[model samples]
Target: MGVHPKESTAQNIENIKRQIGEIAAIYDWDMEVNTTDPEFYKWTQWIFVQMFKKGLAYEKQMPINWCPSCKTGLANEEVVNGKCERCGADVTKKNLRQWMLKITENTDRLLGDLDKLDWPEKFKKMQAEWIGKNHGAEVDFKLEDRDEAITVYTTRPDTLHAATFMVLAPQHKLAAELATDETYHCPKKTMVYTPSLIWKFI
Candidate 1:
């Protein structure tokens, strides 16, 4: 048996057509009929293609914390404490290939246009900070065998020593790979498994 629900082929197609028709319809109290036609879907698809062509949409392998009960991946922010938001099951980290959109690519233009728009000052400031417009150097740290390196962008290189040890996010490539090894698999062995420098710093 499949882990998910199953429907007959006829039922599935009928359901799809029903949903499409319902979505395309607009109801008015005056009984006037309005509908979102296939043209809307075509336009949406065209815009998506434009985004992809501009490199704003791309696919990459990314680890997501998955909640089996929900049968969906949860964003790191979605987990409360250590449990899934939907089912209260303890969330587990899962690695999978997923799509990533370059939201940061439009950061500067969005931030610049914010001032021209009549919005709340607090909201504007929040948007500006979210864009993270900064004059800084991007330093990369690489592993011995890996050609790729982790980049850290910072304005103050002098405070590097104060950093103690790098705190790699659990979702980071390095952190996830290390987590798979027996030496680092034990959560209770947090200090025991972490590098001596990081352990001391933590």
Candidate 2:
């Protein structure tokens, strides 16, 4: 049976459970639980509630990676080069209200405790890079004919004077603003061009 938007969620869940059961039986694997079951999700909900009560979980409005094909919000780790890691679809930036977990608060402790783990050197290095914390200066660029300014973070503040052109990522929140101006036109054929070539006014 094909799983489509028209299919009921209950039917899809049942289909998944059946397929997993068949695979488990063929592989002689012992599958004790189905996370889709109500009992399992109850505990998951309880944990989220506990985290919210402890202030570790909170909601905020922010820019997030969105997969248009999947129609869902994705985490930073789930996006690679402005594409969805799971579906390989082009991802875009979307501003929406989302729940956020304050994991950065433990960045220092997490980095320091990494050495104590038995993981390989490569794995440790990757974790350290993922927890990337760096000091940078926030520079604001005034928009042409617009009162708003875009703020960018850069480690090399001295090199700002030599910058001749501004390139914003396709998934940037401000990229959509370029379309509002009639003078700035991006050709549809050059959509895949690197840097997206939004506005060329120099």
Candidate 3:
């Protein structure tokens, strides 16, 4: 995301070098800045190329919640008190192309190493909470009109006898249409309709 505009080059490059030095100092690492050095840019470019080679970097269009006035997408962790951080405007969902880090592909190995870290009890608990590990079977629901089935992950398969209702994710493509079906008894107003489906399974 860092780029040096040629017109603003000299001043911006010096500022970047200064910030890098400050960050290194805070981390107790010794480093020096040589802004006029071509080696620096070469290293940066090589890092970028390595990332692309590993298929870790790519661009795509993603639907996101954004505030037009602020011109930035709101991350799930960024929404606070129902206001935009940059412009104080109400955020709205929009379809736009955006870049995302592929952390899902690395989730398993990351979680497996959690116990190896020496950390405070509270922080370890938070880490476990963030991982939210659950072991369960994949169950499929047959759609009425479609030949295909929708699969949902449930950690409580042993409690199948008490199935009371079902809930589907709002982002699920079939949710809106499924909500109106007579056989399924989909509740009209809520996004977290899992309990509705779970009830039926009971």
Q: Count the backbone clashes (under 3 Å) in each candidate.
A: 0, 0, 19
Query: Per-residue CA lDDT of candidate 3, range 77-119, in tens?
Result: 6666556766777665555665554555566777778778898
Residue 34, model 2, lDDT = 51
Per-model TM-score on C-alpha atoms: 0.59, 0.57, 0.53
Ranking by lDDT: 2, 1, 3
Winner on lDDT between 1 and 3 is: 1
Model 2 lDDT, residue 176, Cα = 59
RMSD (CA, Å), candidate 3 to true, equals 7.0
Q: Candidate 2, 200: how far from true, in Å? A: 7.7
Instruction: Score candidate 1 by TM-score against the native.
Output: 0.59
Backbone clash total, candidate 3: 19
How would you encode candidate 2's per-residue C-alpha lDDT over 44-155 as one tens digit per residue? 8999998899898999877777788899999999988777899998877666887998878888998999999999999999999999977789998887888877677999
> Lowest-scoring 10 consecutive residues by lDDT in candidate 1?
193-202
Sort the candidates on TM-score, descending order: 1, 2, 3
Per-prediction CA RMSD (Å): 7.5, 6.2, 7.0
